[model samples]
Target: MIIKPMIRSNMCINAHPIGCAKETENQINYVIAQKAKRGTKTLAEGGKAPRTVLVLGCSTGYGLASRITAAFEYGADTIGVSFEKQPTQVKGGTPGWYNNMAFDKAAEKAGLKTKTFNADAYSDECRAEVIKQLKDWGAKADLVIYSLASPVRTDPDTKVMYRSVIKPINQVYSGASLDMMTGKITQASTQPAEGDEIPNTVKVMGGEDWERWIKQLSEADVLADGCRTLAYSYIGPSLSHPIYRDGTIGEAKKDLEKRAHNIDAALKAKGGAAYVSVNKGLITRSSSVIPIITQYLGVLFKIMKKQGTHEGCIEQMERLFAERLYTADGKVPVDSENRIRMDDWEMDPKVQDEVNKVMPAVTEENVNELVDLDGIRHDFLIINGFDVDGVDYNKEVTDMSKIEY
Candidate 1:
């Protein structure tokens, strides 16, 4: 029986379970199509195959993509650890849990091994439980991917609290067009991050948590030889520097980059490596809300897609696994900034140069022609399978209660 829709702020916060399931299948199909285009020679090569992978922040975005890559691209047995769970009515909604269920169903259909731990990744108790579960399965992970984004975290020891904020570094106010109704950009102001916010932002969003996860795994002896760990970052065009790179969040990313190096050093004796891959921005539930970013991404996506070079989160992850991280050569590529450079192509000077030429002129009147705003918006809705084509959005979606990790 389809469930009756619940009203929330005059908008539908509910998702159709069947639609979500179909969306997951679509993503799997996309991976297969992309692989075919890239050729099988570039795919992850394995004789016995790594049986276990631990993917933190596997609820959405890069983390979810990483899990799919491990299961589909490498045929690894996977365990996804995330705080997201099926939302009870009192607790609001379960966007991540439903997505996970869809992923699990698709993976099972493909004969891939999968499990999920719907618990907080930052909590010691949760980590202990995951380690115990792995030990019970008589398995250790050959790969770990940390891709968490949270606004606040309490130190496990100090119990001190930290909150993340995104602001610009300079005293500048920028204009952007925002959808007043949806709070999305149709196209207003992006301000600079305050100087003092930089260090604090880094402390919160950077690599400290990533390193902690690795350390815990190593201490538990759950890390396999030649294991690799990756965390995702973003480096957009210069136009967003004041609001992103030089902003509070940028400071956090810098801290994250530094944390990767520290993690690498700690793992050296164990023949493990830690890396931070700079990833391209796409329309995600998180990225869409950031000021000015929506407009810029809309423009960028349109330009890149037309040139036959655009990539969504899944595409980027597939390439990261096939072309860079797991390549046969054993060499990880880095850019001039001394970090992994997957996002470099997205921010190519020529591309950004062209984007800049049109950004200032992109008003609502000419937005469709100048940018892929509709595509960007559609991707956002598609994240939850709300606005996808061929899906019956009007169908009563009553299975929310059954979605589980």
Candidate 2:
């Protein structure tokens, strides 16, 4: 069946099998191109950079990119845990399902071992299964990457579904934002978190799950020596800070950062460390649903592209593994909060100065002239394997993907 992007609320509801394959191939090609970066090199030049990695939420976005980097670049054995919906003949599976399937196929060809678990990452059953797999492999991870983006989570014990909210915690926020779906600049306001909004947001997006993962991995003895973990976070410019950085989500991030310290201390005896990696804001599915951030992202993407600093999930992960997390000299540079700052280029004083000027000027009339909504849309599409080049969109996918969950 011919498939196209069916997007709503910043998410693509359907995916093309062939396009997803092509997208996965593209990322693998990128890893092959950057052979001298983080991947293994011949002993004559340097040496193999071998690792064992476990990635939670390793289906799409940064998690998928990180898996590719580990296996293709560093020749690492990897196990992935994610909550994803697979495709069927009646309907296209989530892009993540196809991506993960394609990744396993490619890894097999490359003689790399990869295992994926499609289940709620918050469930004890899933956690136990992942740990069991790690034990069987006897290749415990040297690094663990947390990139979960679920809106709600089910409590394993209580079976209660807790949904996360996106709201300012202190005051109602009004700002300029782009409608990624329509390419229209719209003014939006977000109300402050009330009642259980703050706590629920923390319960879902905070570092509790991450900390639990660490504890379980440690108890299971599935974490290799010097094993470190990192979770993704974001802190944008002042214009959107009230609804972003210093808002409800920001409170969760702060708690995550604080947990990093505790996790670090807990793992110190085993030579492990934990960190909150503050990343650049891109057109992620999660970010697209936020208030007043889409406009900033569109504008920022345009400026960053012009400045030769545009980066997507793959670029960001590549730099993180190659430079910040793993370097020839063995150093991990961090911000004052001890968080890894991959937003350096995006937050370049010059970039922020330009963004500040552009944020207030954005309006429906001036949206096109001021920002690159197309660029933002391109990002959102590419991440989901939609609108990809060299992929036949007209082909029937009834037999293309035999993926089942």
Candidate 3:
């Protein structure tokens, strides 16, 4: 059957099987090319790199890019955990399912060891299985990446599920929301969190799960000496703080950042380290739904592309490994806050000034001129395996359960 994107309220609810696989292969090919351009050597070549990596939330966005870079560029054996719906013959699954399948297939072709789990990362059973698999292989993870982006999470002990919200803190947040499909702009506003919403948001999106994963892995002795763990975060410009950095989600990020300190102290005893990498804002599944972000990213993308500093998920993860995480002198550079600032280019003074100048002037008439509407539309479509290059959407998907990468 031929598949097309079914989008509602800026969310793509359906995915294409072959398109997802092709996009995953595209990222792998990109990293392979960068290995030569950047002189990236694998551990087999006596280079400093991760030997065995574990990536939580490893299906899409930054997590998938991290896995691809670790396996393709650093030549690391990887175990990935993410919750995704599997496809059947009549219907397609989530984009992540096909992405994982493609990643596993490509890894096998490259002779890199890989195991992907379609299980919830928040459950204890999933943790136990990962630990058992690590023991079975007798491989300790040298790099652990936490990049989970879920709307709800169940507490492994209490059996209570908590859902996260994207609301402001104390005041009503009103911002311009851009419709990527139609180029229409509308005012979107959300009230402050009340009752258990703030804590619940924290419960779902905060650092508790991250801390638990690390503690369990350390106890099970599955973490290698001098191991490094990283979690991804984003802090856009002040314009987006009301709906992002200063919102309920911001409270969760602060908790995650705080836990990084405790985790860092514990890991330091083993010569290991922990950090919260403040990454750039990009068109992500979750980011697409947030207020003011779509418009902000539209303007940001236009200016950054003009400046020749635009980076998608793959490019960002590649630089994280080649420049920040693995330096030649064994020193990982960071900002004064003890965090790696990957959004440096996006937050540059000149870029923000340009964005500030252009955002207010954006209307239906000048929308295309002011923002990279086409660029963001392409990003939004490709994230769900639609509008990707070199893929014939008219072809039939003979089997939904499998893909040829």
Best by lDDT: 3
Tens-place lDDT digits, model 2, residues 1-405: 566788776777667777777888888889777875445452234653437888999988889999998788777888998877765567667778888898998898988888999998998888899889988877687888998888898877688888888898778888655677687655678878899988888888899889998888888888888888999998878877788778878888888898989999998888878888888888877788777778888889889888889998888887887878777776789988889999999889999999988877777887887888788888788777777888766665566355321
* Cα lDDT tens digits for candidate 1, 1-405: 444344332234665555555666666777777657755432235333356888988867788888887786667778898776465543434556766887887778878768888887777887898788789888888888888888777778887777777777766646575442243344246555555556656767888878888889889998888788888888788877777887788878888888888888887787878888898888765566666777788889888998999988788888888778766677778765457878877878889898899888877677678778677767766666566566766665444545421
Query: Candidate 3: what lDDT?
Result: 0.93
Candidate 2 residue pairs in clash (backbone atoms < 3 Å): 1-396, 1-397, 39-73, 87-93, 178-295
Best by TM-score: 3
Error of 1 at 17 (Å): 2.9
Q: What is the C-alpha RMSD of each candidate to the true structure, in Å?
A: 3.5, 2.4, 0.8
lDDT values, one for every candidate: 0.73, 0.82, 0.93
Give the winner by lDDT: 1 or 2: 2
Instruction: Give lDDT for model 1.
Output: 0.73
Candidate order, TM-score descending: 3, 2, 1
Model 1 deviation from native, Cα RMSD in Å: 3.5
Per-candidate TM-score against the hidden true structure = 0.88, 0.94, 0.99
The local lDDT score (0 to 100) that residue 236 gets in candidate 1 is 86
**Against the true structure, candidate 2 has what lDDT?**
0.82
lDDT of 3 by residue, 1-405 (tens): 787889999999999888899999999999999999988999999888999999999999999999999999999999999999988888789999999999999999999999999999999999999999899989999999999999999999999999999999999999888999999999998899998999999999899999999999999999999999999999899998997899999999999999999999999999999999999999988888888899999999999999999999999999999999889998989988789999999999999999999988999899999889999999999888899899999998888877863
